[model samples]
Target: MLEEKGIKPAVVAGLSLGEYSAFVKANVLSFKEAVQLVKKRGQYMTDAVPLGKGAMSAIMGLDRQTIKDACEEASILGVVSPANYNMPGQIAIAGIKEAVEKAGEILLEKGAKRVVPLQVSGPFHTQLLEPASIQLKEAITAISVHEPTLPVVSNTIAEVFKDKEQIKDMMVKQVMSPVYWEDSVRTMIDLGVDTFIEVGPGKTLSSFIKKIDKTVTILNVENEKTLEKTMKKLAELEA
Candidate 1:
């Protein structure tokens, strides 16, 4: 689906498993390696916490500070913390079920537009996932990772991996750090990337990019038809 579109991402970024895909695209690892790493990551994360003990929620229409305050205000029963800072008004918070629920209530009371609970096994990007992060760190150093052909922005800092050592460290930290998604998109724009092609299972990334900059040419390629269309558009741009 990706190759057909000629939408080779100049700077590939991913959200969770999407990071594995980005690594594969960047030739840092083979397809088999990517799959193996993700599988191991999933297993480690799952084993770190008991099943049904953790959860995530998307609190929209609220800024980061507001959401942070809400999480801090509602930090009861379990660890509620902001996971992914998707955009100015969109953030995903993760922690124990009760803490997440309390945070959601506080946000809603404070005029948050909506709080949607995510279907996830563990509280990703939180201290609750530190055990998984530690285990994953060992696995990352053990694996063979090479520099990407182009800049690969990390979710944790929204910065491109410029140093091999940083790349190695960021991989582990990303497992338990808030994804600086908004900053990443902004940085890409600042670097003159007017076009964004999200190659994945859904159009979520593209949607977020649009929210970041409506004028940017953003497209999602999930099937043959979209792939063909994207290729045609890319060709036109080249012409």
Candidate 2:
């Protein structure tokens, strides 16, 4: 719709599974393929971890190294690592429930401002999701992927995907690797993306992008109202 007004994304990206949407926008995956692949991806992840065994938590106001050290210390209990680096002072950790809780405690003791546990199905974006990665690789390989019409940033490596061939491996590694959202957003800024539009249901990405770089224009389209507002903002930017 924005294209009709001579506006389009300079580069595309999303958080976690949201990456699929970025791929769709970049023409790496057709809308239909994205839907089917996402469904199977969900199924595989559910099958990978039993409910209550895995967990995630948001550790706020802590440095990356502090959080990493806490997770490493807590790994004695089970798998635990930094799952998502959401913003400057906020990072999410995931792994076995025991380890996550333990890491949270350690982070707090280490002077973290807050360690808030998240209500999630299973420990995503960690080694716990390895099974899901393997399954997703096969599913993605079955599809007809094309090189991106525009750059699509990857969450795992915090870099733009190269071509059709990189998608499967990137997707496979993504499931078990931490999402460098903060880094990805920085990469976009370096790419000269002065504006961002979060085209989904929530403004979480908008919030993170704002934290990463306040100067960039951020917009969202979740409903009719937001779409109208976003278009108005884009029009003004264009003007």
Candidate 3:
């Protein structure tokens, strides 16, 4: 659809599961391979933590270092660490249910405006998911990956993938590493990206981009109405 409208992005990046989409767009993984890999990855992650044992929570209105410290302090209870550095004040922490709850309390006491628990299957992007990461590495190694036609920023490294090997390695590490979303967005901005079009079912990425840099144009295409609106906006920008 974007090609039909004569729109091409200079760079591409994705968050969490969205990274697979970026890989597909960059021609690094075929649709079939991506689907198969994701299926296995999902199963591995699900199996990594027992049901009711893991949890995740969103901490808002707190700086990154404070949240990190809270997680470290909560580590005594069990595994707990920052998961997604979504934006300036919004971050997610994941780990054992007890540790996550403990960290949330600490975050609140440390001046966080709000801490909401997230309903997720496992404690992702933390050491607890190391088993999943190992499984994902084997799964990824079984598949063939190609160098992207355009640079694709990595959530784990907050930088463009250097080569196909790095892409494979990062895909594995990303399973157990915090998503450096803000850094990735800033990197794109530094590379002169003024317009960001999120092509997915949700507006989460668009919202994050808006919070990251309000000066940049943000658009999302989830349905026909949004697609038309985005097309008109793009036309205006091009004109």
Candidate 4:
């Protein structure tokens, strides 16, 4: 579909399972390989953490440091830490159920507009997910990963991973580290990428990209209808 539309991505990045898709799109690995890796990631994440013991929450209208301070003050018996730094004032925290609950309470006390708990199988992108990282590392290292044709930012550091080895290491660490998505979007903007095309099952990334930078042209392709619209947009943009 991308080829049919002549929509060449100048900078492609992804989140969580979307990372594997980005790799496939970048031609670093085949789609089959990427799917297999996601299966492994899903299995490892589920098996490493017990159900209902882990949780996630979004703390809106708070700075990163304030959220960090809140998490530290709210830590109870289990692990809790910031997971996804979505945008300037939005961040997702993840860890033990009790810890997340405690953190939410602290955020509310801090005058945060909203603290909403997320439905997830595990406390993703936190220390609690380290075991899954270790397991996934072995599988990822076995695959033949190459440098991306376009700049592909790492969720772990919000920087473009230039080397294959660095990409491997960062991929493992990303399982247990916060995704600096806000920083990533800014970085791409600094690099002069004024357009973002999100191709996947959901429109979540496109929404975040718009929230991060409304001035940039954002197109999301999931179904055939959206694909056709995106093709038309690409033609107009290139013309």
lDDT, model 2, position 183: 98
Q: For candidate 3, what is the total of clashing residue pairs?
A: 0
Rank by lDDT, descending? Answer: 3, 2, 4, 1
TM-scores, one per candidate: 0.94, 0.96, 0.98, 0.95
Query: The CA-based lDDT of model 4 is what?
Result: 0.85
Residues 1-239 of candidate 1: C-alpha lDDT, one tens digit per residue = 66643446667888766777877788877788778888888998898879998889999898888899989988867799999988778899999889999999999999999999998888988888889999998888777888787788877787788866787788788888888888888988888889998876788888888888989988777778888887888788889
- lDDT by residue (125-198, candidate 3, tens digit) is 99888999999988887898999999899988889899999999899999999999999999999989999999
Tell me the deviation in Å of residue 127 in model 3.
Answer: 0.8
Minimal lDDT window, size 10, model 3: 1-10
lDDT, residue 75, candidate 1: 85
lDDT digits (tens) for residues 1-239 of candidate 2: 56664668878988999999999989888999999998998999999999899999999999999999999999999999999999999999999999999999999999999989999899999998999988888888788888899999998898888887887788888888999999999998898889988887888998998889999999888777887898898778879
State the lDDT of candidate 4 residue by residue for 1-239, as single tens digits: 88665657887788866777778878877888888888898999898789999999999998888899888887865789999998767899999999899999989998888998897888999998889999999999778888878778777787887887888888788888888888888888998988888887888778888889989999878889999898888789989
Query: Which numbered prediction scores highest in lDDT against the true structure?
Result: 3
Predictions in order: lDDT: 0.84, 0.91, 0.93, 0.85
Q: Can you tell me which runs of candidate 1 are displaced by over 4 Å?
A: 1-7
With a 3 Å backbone cut-off (N, CA, C), the pairs that clash in candidate 2 are none
How should the candidates be ordered by TM-score, best one leading? 3, 2, 4, 1
What does the lDDT come to for candidate 2?
A: 0.91
Q: In angstroms, how far off is 41's CA in candidate 3?
A: 0.4
